[model samples]
Target: MPAKRRPRRPADDSLAANLRFFAILMIAAILLRSLVAAPFSIPSESMLPRLLVGDYLFVAKWPYGWSRHSFPFSLAPIDGRIGGAVPARGDVIVFKTPGDNRTDYIKRLIGLPGDQVQIRGGRLILNGEPVPKLRVADFLDPVSPNSPCRPVPGLRIRLARAADGGAVCRYPRYRETLPGGRSYDVLDIGTTPADDTPVFVVPEDHYFLMGDNRDRSADSRFPAEPGGGIGYVPAENLVGRAMVTFFSTDGSAGWLMPWTWPGATRWNRIGEGF
Candidate 1:
């Protein structure tokens, strides 16, 4: 004969309910961040004139498909990208730093595997051809925390008054057109050491990346350091493609100053495409 089932206890029922709810929430969050989309915050001015410090953007996970790097803790057990799609020449992307394969980095995709890339006189050289760069109006920069555009090493900056009477800093900005008509703005702080580099032949399963803020960035031009400089990023290290900026702040407001928060928000940069 079948034994009578044990009666469900109230305490046991409550504990099980709570555990189930927590599990559901964890599962949902995991799925959303992994399969759907993920939020990334810009911590530096590396991609300046395109992505600024304090910018919050969304990274679309589906563009390059899934690799082991796609999963948090990188536990996918996969070798290369699955359902992978080769990114275009000018797409802005966030990927794992080459040395660690753990640190997150955002930069423009400048070279593909086997592509010859270099910088000469601050101009990007792709496949032995110089990418066209057109000078644009000076980019007006306001005083923001950790803004790389200002306190420039060797240039005189003309100051301007903003509507709020805050001192405005100015930096030279230019438009760079890559091959196939893709173009974006970049900030140049005269010629720096990074402006000229030995020709880097992108290796198989690797990519060459550089920041729009050419003078300030230490990208593929620098050899990979354990926790610092990024070298040749592996194609499998790609996390996602930057799609849009959902929020931005200039660090003008303090946590205690709730009323000033809205004013500190960069409303104009919201919904900006990358």
Candidate 2:
């Protein structure tokens, strides 16, 4: 006769199957966020015109290769970036704020390694040549809890709705042309302290970032200390290059309310490319 077989426990087999499914799902998530793309949300007007405060977009991790910063919470134990790639002049990027590894900052890559950068009279000067800033149509921002277009430095305005239940805010806008024929929109609030800055030569393996909102942005132009301004960002700190906008909201919706999605979502901005 054949040898007797022990009975299998159905509950134990089911528990093992559940654990395996969760493990595989977690691995897939980490791989996608690390090697393919990851989602990020805009929290400020630093990247205005193209990116808004309530916009949610994807950052492509493959463009700049693998680095510790590519991982969520930067949990990797590597020394530096592997298969690293430098972001282009006009490419928008997300990186760990210099000196404060915990913070993530997004901005346009202006000064590349060894490039001389400065702001003179509300215009960007690269390598002693002034980058052209031409006046453009006013940039209109709809009045909402999310689109106040508020500038930095403790300035606040009471937002109000229009008579038609819709309103908009306006600001002076301009087109800034960087070297290599790249151009983007910028907003300027006349003159500010950053309008004139001393020439800063970008060091090797480093980059200088700036915001499209000009004077309102606290980028490499300020000290990265208690003032909380971002300074020169390192290559190893790079997270990824911004690719496209996935979703956006008007800041009037809450998580528990599903009905608000139709009105609160900015459908036009969805699938917008960076």
Candidate 3:
């Protein structure tokens, strides 16, 4: 005898369909984040001026080629195989902190592999040639407006008119030209601790990095002292290059509840290319 016809359950079918859709969505997101660009928020002012504290920037994973550091969670077991082209000097890159590989750091690459780098008399010298540095303005900490931190005693502050017709205060913008004619901005907090120091020759397969906010950044200059920076970083620790700022918000502005998102968002910085 034929058994009773089984009934198709709508609820079971719907659940299975929903699970498949969610799974697909999650996989797509993972793939996009892993292969394409991903957004990273600046947690510290170490990269200041170039990348503010609340700025969210996009890091291009393919520019320097993929390394274990390029993968999501930085879980590639193999070490240093994917660097196709060596990172150029003056490129702003994100890398793993040398002292602790677990921590990620972002800084401008000053010394390339096999390059001589030193700080003498508040100037950067690459391979015995002094990189030109011109003081442009003074930098003030917007987060702490009334803080005592100001431009160095000798240096002067320069206020530039923004495109929006508003005045923005900044510490002198110095044109620091590298040995290869790569020039970028540098900030001098007038005779800070890092201004005068000994010379360091960058070893092979390693690089010297520093923050745009020279006086405030703990970079290759300091070496794990009570309040120092981690030394030179190896090529294996490099993650990617920071390309542009995708989002930014004023750190002082935040919502107490869910209703304040519209007000808290920094509209000006949205879609603003770096």
True-structure lDDT of candidate 2: 0.85
lDDT of model 1, residue 90: 86
Candidate 3 Cα errors over 4 Å, as ranges: 1-8, 137-170, 224-228, 256-268, 271-274
* Residue 72, model 1: Cα distance from true site in angstroms: 1.0
Rank the models by lDDT, top first: 1, 2, 3
Tens digits of lDDT, candidate 2, 154-245: 33222445557767766678998887899899888667889899999999988999989886688999877533677788889889999999
Cα error, candidate 1, residue 207 (Å) = 0.8
Global lDDT scores for all candidate models: 0.86, 0.85, 0.73
Better by lDDT, candidate 3 or 2: 2
Highest TM-score, which number?
A: 1
Model 1 residue runs over 4 Å out of place are 1-6, 146-149, 156-159
Quote the lDDT for 10 in model 1. 100
1-274 in candidate 3: lDDT tens per residue? Answer: 9999889799989999999999999989866765667778887767666666677888877777776766777776766756457888889888878776767788999988777888887888888888888766544434332122333456555455555664565565677777677777777656766887788888887889999878779899888433358688888877778888777766434457656555555667677553
- Poorest lDDT segment (10 consecutive residues) of candidate 1: 148-157
Q: Estimate each model's TM-score.
A: 0.92, 0.91, 0.81
